[model samples]
Target: MIAIDDILEKIVSKEIEKKEALRFFEELPEKEKSYLVSKLKTHLSNNANSVENNFSEKKERTLKAVTELQLNEEHKGFIDQMAQKLEKNAPKSKENASECQTYFVDQRRTGGLKKALKRLQFHLTYSECDGAYLYDIDGNKYIDIASDNGVNLFGHQPDFIKEAISKRLDKGYPLVGYTEELSQATKLFSELTGHERVLFTQSGTEAVMWAVRIARAATQKKKIVIFEGAYHGLSDTVLAAKDQFGNSIAMGLGMIQEFADELIVLDYGNMEDLSIIEDRADEIAGVLVEPVQSRNPNNQPVEFLKEVRKLTLEKNILLIMDEMITGFRVSCSGVQGLWKIKGDLATYGKIPAGGMPSGMIAGLTKYMNYVDGGTFDYDDESMPSVKKALMAGTHTRNPIKLAATLAILTEIKKRSSTSENKTDESNSCFLQELNEKTRLMCEELNSFFKTKNVPLIIEYFSSLFRFKFLDDPNGVVKELVFVLMRINGVETSPSGNCFLTLAHSDKDIKSIIRVVKKSIDTLMKQNFFYISDSIEEDEIKEDIRSTISTIPDMRNDPEQESIKNDQMEKLRKLIISDLNNFQEKEVTI
Candidate 1:
């Protein structure tokens, strides 16, 4: 087999240009090419971002204080504009104010609200999203990157899984315990992933919890190993070691430090970090990891992952891969499908069960026997329920979401069916195209932005890209995000990273890149080139303050941000509102 380095080294050393290099890659065995592509991309990863001023103490104060303010007219205009773009894949349902009475409180009831409404001319109202699109009360649409946070993969209400769940609804939700739906769902999950069993849970975090408990129970180990700068759901234990600011080292506040003692924070990409606990591997029940850290948009290089697989095996440590984000996005089956990885225990959610709010923990047959089959020699059925009690939650194999998930996965399977080893040409060439497109876009975006002398970084992996909002203390990236939000008919966002969803066509992506290009051009013309490698902190502060000042202050006019104060008063009683709706915030899905 030809190695990836054999190909990339040739490309890097100018033995061949990229086009010829790609042709060489195309002619190689499928596995060889996949390996080579990964190698080639990594070989190009240089620190493309230039350092910018950090947030100042005063700006931090402003952000913290923003919680008390209200949205102004310009802010409202911006919000309305952004809302339209967010509807790219939303279900086309007319949103009548009367229809959403169940979810949002009417803002006309209170005397203060009525008086306030009399005071303002317009209102800005938002609705909760379902999958790929967002709907507004007043006939506006948005492409929903917001809702995919953890569970928007199936493209919403897909017909495949919906029919399966709808049939269940017709059957009266079925009997609750050990039912056929549970069995079939688990069956599909285990079969697809090569796991022996599945324990269904409600959410990704809940599944994370169960995976940890079962690991402790099976190995009788008090400790677990995790990676730094990784988020493993928001469970108390998992949230403990978070790095809030980007030092690569993360620490969490609410988690008890004592738990931190039991948890080993292995610097990502280090296998020796595992050796520190080598003698303690048996004392370690499992190692939990995100195939690719969702927070950092950077991939776990091939070597790091290969080492992880090796160390876990060498130390006899059970591998618990947390696939909540990477499950359906990276490959049709999952990230493990992309790599030759099989975990002893794995967690699934995000696109499985279609898009319905669902989760499950899967384990290999040998390791899962304790949680399955009979306990006390079949004399007690109580043990099975113990697992059930931990796993079950307001379960919705929702017909609509499940249907969407099925469609999404089926398409993924179809796209990925071609194995490099097989003689069949029906391979995941389409996805490879998408991956190539992403790489090109990342490279082009980086080069274009750099040419403008903008010291920003746009990093992409698979279909997702994280735009490193330049180190500009003036919040240029935030401004660009706001511009994307405000642009008509373009629902690009600075959040949820970026999406290369099924609904997003080549044209839609081109529009994004176009806007990004324009924005970079504008920023380059305006951004001051640094005088030397050193930046002027005072100038950064002044720019930030002055830029923020230009936005009309919304603090004095709460009623104007939404419906009139009258409507807002009524709405306030029902809906939770954000005080800092204009503030730049980063969200992970």
Candidate 2:
């Protein structure tokens, strides 16, 4: 019998292309070939990236060999499937890129980015996306849990959005000025968000940047209070970070420290932070917050939100809600509506534009008019015209974006069971249902963690889901879980934030949990969790055994064993925890 290693070696060394190597290896019986492929995958899993780099020169030859062979359809399918999987799993792929590789490779070459990707153990390079799935450069499919950082909430290329774009195209691409589409879009947004008016921008970041600018202008105060772990935008004022000693500082070098100093970073959901607001009331222009912070979505405290509103009101400070993720995501009226507290100003993006590249600042006329070209037409509010903030962009109200937004919001409101004339509680609609589904899934996963004694927990806040490893204070475990999920065909953010849309069916939800469990199993078999110096190897194994003993061997169980069995027990516990968490949370919700 020829060794599989020798065949792989020849392919790697470029002595033969992958097609030739596959033919040589196929001399073995079908069963043996399957076994050999599995073995080869296990051996090359960690080294996939390195192998690609070494064989960069042979890539075209191997690709051409596959095309040159006039194999039967079934044979071609098998080879294609495996080849795509290998390519998707490969660590590097710049040579065959269709788009500019800088988007994927520029940061990847840096030591920090490389190390970060390595720790996660997955390198994603996408070519196209449709619906709720993505097709990578290698043609491997993935269930997109990340949802383009929450922008693709309705999934990719929905029929409504496509139709909207098509209709707009027929109108001759009105890119010059305000079209009927732009007017309709802004009107729809104002109606949905209950904001008196809005100023459109290109992205969520831009929206938040404008929100801060308006707040400072209206209040005539330089200091802006923000919560820790809250992502407002990339603007200089909001790009500041807090140090270990709790001092506010700039995140990157180019950012001016003097401007960053004006940002008062406070702890989210903490009363102490509220007290600081009271102390600095005179100096504060506004308190910017993410009702459900992206980094820790599940940690939103209702009382805290109400408190923020009360304090801001009592102190005469502007309250700016950074609703980039929560706008139209949590509800049509957003977090403020759900929680029954309103912000003086709010920045919106993500699903607001129907998954298009758009953003806007929604607020009362008093603040919004400042950006409406220094015009203050409101009855009671007349500030100095000199205090007005300038806000404009070339694509601010692009007709195509306006058309897409109008279509998306119209659809979302309909799906939410909300009508143009009625003002029903939005929490009773589609958005709530998605959040319920997500919450139940988290509960199921957490139960499995407890059963297996793994120090991990899945958290659900609204429609956002994130997994946490309690012991991983630095978040490496969370990052690894993201890579593992991708390996199992589910892609999400490194923050462990998985955004769900109305498009995700019950089956897709089940698949997400199943793949996540399988990823956990893979990590266990590879002993990836043992990276912690504090945990002993023996205890980990014993914990795995005791937790999964209730189920059949995880590696072979028809229902539980989705992957290999080398560390089957750990994964078995993980899967059951996931399943049970869903079931239990379903009952509770």
Candidate 2 lDDT, tens digit per residue, 1-589?
1344344434332334444554565465433343343333323331232224332343322111111122346533443454465454643543444244546564323211222233233345788888778888666688888887888777898999999988988987656667887777777778778888888899888888888888888888888988866788778878765532234666554667787778887778778668778977998999999988887776678898899899999998999988888777778888888888889999888787776788888888888877854454577777456445777788887888888888987887677664333454552366777778878887877666554445566666778776654432223344445655766788776445678777788988899889878766654554444322222322333343344444332221245324433333344345335334433432100
lDDT of 1 by residue, 1-589 (tens): 2234444444443333334544564466433432343333222222112232322222322111010012346444544443454433222321333345558685332211111121121222446444355555545665543335535444445455566667656666432444455544555556556677767666778888888877777677777778765677767665433111111111233345566556765567765565655756767778888778776666466677767778778876788888877775665446676776767888878766565666668877656655554233457545442232123355534334344444545555555564454522223345566567667777887777555555456766666666664333122233444344434334444233565555555665666677777655543333322323222332433333333234332222345545233432332222111112211221000
CA lDDT of each prediction against the hidden true structure: 0.51, 0.65
Candidate closest to the true structure, highest TM-score = 2
TM-scores of all predicted structures: 0.62, 0.70
Error of 1 at 360 (Å): 2.5
- The 10-residue segment of model 1 with minimum total lDDT is 60-69
CA-only RMSD, every prediction: 18.5, 18.0
